[model samples]
Target: MKILKYIKTNVLIYFLIGMFLNSGLSLIKPLLLERLLVIQEDQLTLDMVLSFILYGFCLHLIFYSTMLLANFVSNNLQRHLQLRLKNQLFRKLFLEDAFIDDEKVSIVTQEMELLYDQFFLPLDLIIGKSFILFTTIVFILWQNLWLGLFFVAFSLLRPLPQWLMNSRLNNSGAAFSKNQKNFHLSVGDFFRGADTFYFYGVAREKMSMLEKYNEDYENARWRNEWTNNIVFFFNGPIEFFSQVLPLALGLVMQERGAELTTAGLIAMYIATMNINGPLQSIMYSVSDIQRSGVVRERIFSILEDSSVEYSYHTVDNVSELVLENVSKNIGERILFQNLSLNLSQPSKVLIKGASGTGKSTLLRIIAGKIRPDTGRLYVRTSKGEEFSQFQGNIAYISQHPFFTHGTIRDNLTFGQEFSDKQLLYYLDQVGLTGEIPSILDYHLINNGENISGGQRLRLELVRCLLREKDIVLADEITAALDRENAKRVRQLLSSLPIILVEVAHHIDSEMHYDQMINLKDYR
Candidate 1:
């Protein structure tokens, strides 16, 4: 119903009109023939024939035109739903990142599309076809009572096999959905880390793993396809009966000297053919209904779940951030234990070691990106009112900074309401003034591709400076720069009043810091 709930009463009015037109169109031939044979007492006239022909044409005209309008309305609704769902999922993936695991990317891209196709599409079909079927059945009963009763009895039997195998079919669909997502995620990982695999001489192994995932997906696909085949196999005979028997039995009754007129028998045949498509739709729609039900359940699990809590309290007049006896263990490996530190004033700290020394991880904890396993993280205010944590108060620059798809200025300022003057000033400070050809409006295609690596770092620096947070966490900001520019960046950071935590292997030895954390000695 959540899927159907989107079709507002106003648009639903048009959709219902579409269904009504479809139902009305099914009645045209039957009524026309009945009027000629029975109502006119077999004294059919040229004027009567011509009148019916024109009237039938007009009904078809309205039907097709209303159908077009209904299609446009449904499409607009689908697009709106896609946009709204994408925005919510984007926030979940990027903002509330605590819920992110291996399947996050796959869920955001693949499952979103799945939800659209499997859930909403089937509901749309059901709305259109169900009304047509209901209306046609009513007309059938009005025209020939015995035939109508027989048709209804047979149509009910169409779902017997479907009901029996409902659980098996649903399980098959759900398993395939899971396999498809897992396969995509694995393929994405293989592509993203191709260089790493190549360096390790494990490229072949990665390919084999991808092949395994592909095989798993293929197995699920084949199983689901076979299950569908079995369902349709049962449905095939019933559909054949529904489509053919009404016309057959009506003709048989006429041969047996039934009271049915020649025109009436022809009308009944036309009526049966007209109702067949919608009847088949009603039967086949069960599978789609079940599939969508499963998909809806999956989507609801995500939207209804709020296990990841983000409590960011931006404290006023906060001069010091303290971590008391903090310890963290990632799996079996310990990253930090009893890591107590005090930052009461503007300070410069450089954290550095080998790659696995948890330098970035430590900075992440300070920035509230992760929690310490054993100890408390606190931001002690100057007024002695300590808050739970800090996320917004600290500006972070990652080793590989990322940007959303947008212009240079869009990525630089983020969502901050800043003027052109503020932007240009920060760009100037980071020495990225003439480097960007379009200046503030430079179009950054695919995460700042128009800019060089050094320019990317400078752009990040500009964004950081614009924030003006009390603490700046810079992780390998100077990694992409040459000696001269790197020195300039280091010196610029040291001169700032904000507490700076820099993690770099290529540190400027001449630059002075209030504290130094060489992870080799600290560990």
Candidate 2:
């Protein structure tokens, strides 16, 4: 059903045309071979042989054309579904407030790939192959009832083993997926905090953790392989019998003096060969699809979240942000309780607290990056209507600013189109242009590796200010800046009308704030 929604009518029309044509062409070889066999007995007139060859050549042309069209349709459909599923999953992650393991995202991407191969890859083939197999059997039955029964019986046997081992396959697949996710997470964490791991001398500990995941993944893989081997065991003999049994039966029928032309026997052999391939595909595809259950579950776990629905909300105004009776906890220890803040007007609020006191967490909650255990957050308009979100009016600048691999202008404007003059104005406000003359068009490596720490902060500040948001949440943004640059940033914040919530340990005595909350005492 989802596939149909994205498939274009022109593409679908081509797909259908190709499918019927493929099925029609499957009988061509058998028919031509049957005729050629008859002509050989008479030493065949030139006219008869050429006519037969011409017919086969014409059918081959149509066969290749239909095959090309079918491939084009299926390839496009696969790409469309891949992108659609990816966007839905990406949107879910972008909106999720609660913790979702990074490794799980890695697993989700892998699952999408496997799902495409197991499910979508063979989707159109199911229709085309089933039709071809059904018609082949009907044609065989028209010639001889016993031959049709033989083909059907063996085809049924091939899938029986897959059914027997399906439960084991599902269990193994799920276990492998879990272990693989853990393995990826471990490797990712090691690289992300390689310096800490080295300083702590916990390389052995991380290796031990990784080994556990590796062992579990290998064990699950072996179990899945065992289950597959069981399936192959049954399919092997069925495949052999599909080809060999027909010839054995034909010889017996001929000895028993059955009435049939030599051409009919040759057609039967060609049909037997043609029918078995499609039958084998249909049978094994059933098990392959079943094995991808873990993949489907992992991908949908992100795509089917109810929380994503409420992430985007309407607000009448962005002037005020309210947090009522907010509480947060980490495990047993309460970070904060019954915390209430009402910012009716724009102000520079400094959150002061010792390390690990949840100051950053509190700011994240305000930014809607994390949800408090208990609280009601609302944005009130001048007309008195409340909305859950403040839209794009709240800009979040983290300790380490995020920068994609693109030009400075690309990062600053993002999706919002800005004139070069307007971009330069914001750049000037953030003191970015003064440091680097050609700031806007300047390209950065991945995550702005080409720029210094202060430059990164300034570029991010400019990026946010370009939107002219009503509020800014800066979490230790000036921690990396020198006194001169930090003083410059503090003065720049004073000039802006936006509400600023900054969590910084280093503040000059001259820096003024509308409110300062020492979180250690904010009950």
Candidate 3:
């Protein structure tokens, strides 16, 4: 039943009813018009003619009202479905710790927009055109079996164009979408780093890259347009056949002396013309349906792909973290090998390493952002059992801190329930209390753009303090701070009861640390 659920079910009954009424109205008009012309002298009366006209008008009114209702349902269903899918994508991108390549992420984001459009609009066409096609086929059979066969045979010709257009449109649209993302990304990179370009005197070089990206996009767009135009041009011939073929067939029957009256022949022609409307509708709908299929497939690929699974394993109360025989290799290059370390709670340790010595990689492995191929990460619990866990009792901060758009206080609290007194205490400890003289409600842009780099770093440090995590892993927390502020940060970190494992380039020997692990010595 869940599989059967779709936008069509919401308004399908109303659409079907409208279609039947339209077919009935179409069938009656030709017969009534023919009788009126044939029996103009005596067989037809003004009152009878007036009654038929009124009946036709009423049928049209009902059909139009149902169409309005159907449209409303379709629009509502599309809005709901698009929102649902977008929400799912947002969750997967932001919440799930999946190893997604940057290029793949860009491709998926572009495809998501296409999926939203297809779900909202093309779904209606798919449903509506399918119904029309079905009704047309049934009507044709009922009118005349042999004529229906002929019409069906001619209609099959439309599918050739449909197949050809569908094959090219999907491939071209995907290529166009990919090229468009690259073009936009290239333009954005150029503008975002304009200062760097000026400093290096490479403005002309960047401009050349932009031109190349634009040219690639243009070629892709032209290919897509050419394919679509071919489909459109082919549709014109199909439309002509839908009308002219039926009329020509009626004339042949009359010339053959088949006992067909003039009105009957005209009625048959009208019925045939009615079939053409649905046929054309079907062709357009097929194109849309194919496009939507591509989008749907792309979306599903992301949602269904296997990600690194996290075990729900946890500890009662973590007191220490241990990394045993941990080894990491990126492609053919070894980052770290057989490395072992222990970090005990209520203790401070400094990790001293030069650039490119796997300091950041180790932090990522501990944070559960990246998984090691061969290793066991154990958490020593208060119960005396070393439990292997992925994410718990740890808060790791990167060199570049991410701050949401908000005031200084908002960035520190991070939406947690914290008292103003507690907030002030942490800010005062980090030497940011002097930055804002007034109350802590001053608005700041996202990523703390209004504040200095040192101030933002201090704010992030305070945020980590507020989390009250069991273990803290910081990467160059004092890199941007002045000597005085850096001392204050060092003092604040020394006072925390949580286990602190820091990656630092400049570690003052005077600063008290329980242990100093040198990565260079391990290698």
Among these predictions, the greatest TM-score belongs to 2
The estimated TM-scores of all candidates read 0.81, 0.87, 0.85
Clashes of 1: 0
Residue pairs clashing in model 1 are none
Cα RMSD to the true fold for all candidates: 4.2, 3.2, 4.0
In Å, residue 266's CA in model 2 sits off its true spot by 3.4
Best by lDDT: 2
Q: Give the Å shift of residue 518 in candidate 3.
A: 1.2
Ranking by lDDT: 2, 1, 3
TM-score ranking, best first: 2, 3, 1
lDDT per residue for candidate 3 within 21-82, as digits (tens), equals 44443344555555555655665778877876886677667666656665665566666655
Task: State residue 457's C-alpha deviation in candidate 3, in Å.
Answer: 0.9
Worst 10 residues of 1 by lDDT: 1-10
Q: What are the lDDT scores of the predictions, listed in order?
A: 0.74, 0.74, 0.69
In terms of lDDT, the poorest run of 10 residues in model 3 is 1-10
Error at 121, model 3, angstroms: 2.7
Q: For all candidates, what are the clash counts?
A: 0, 0, 0
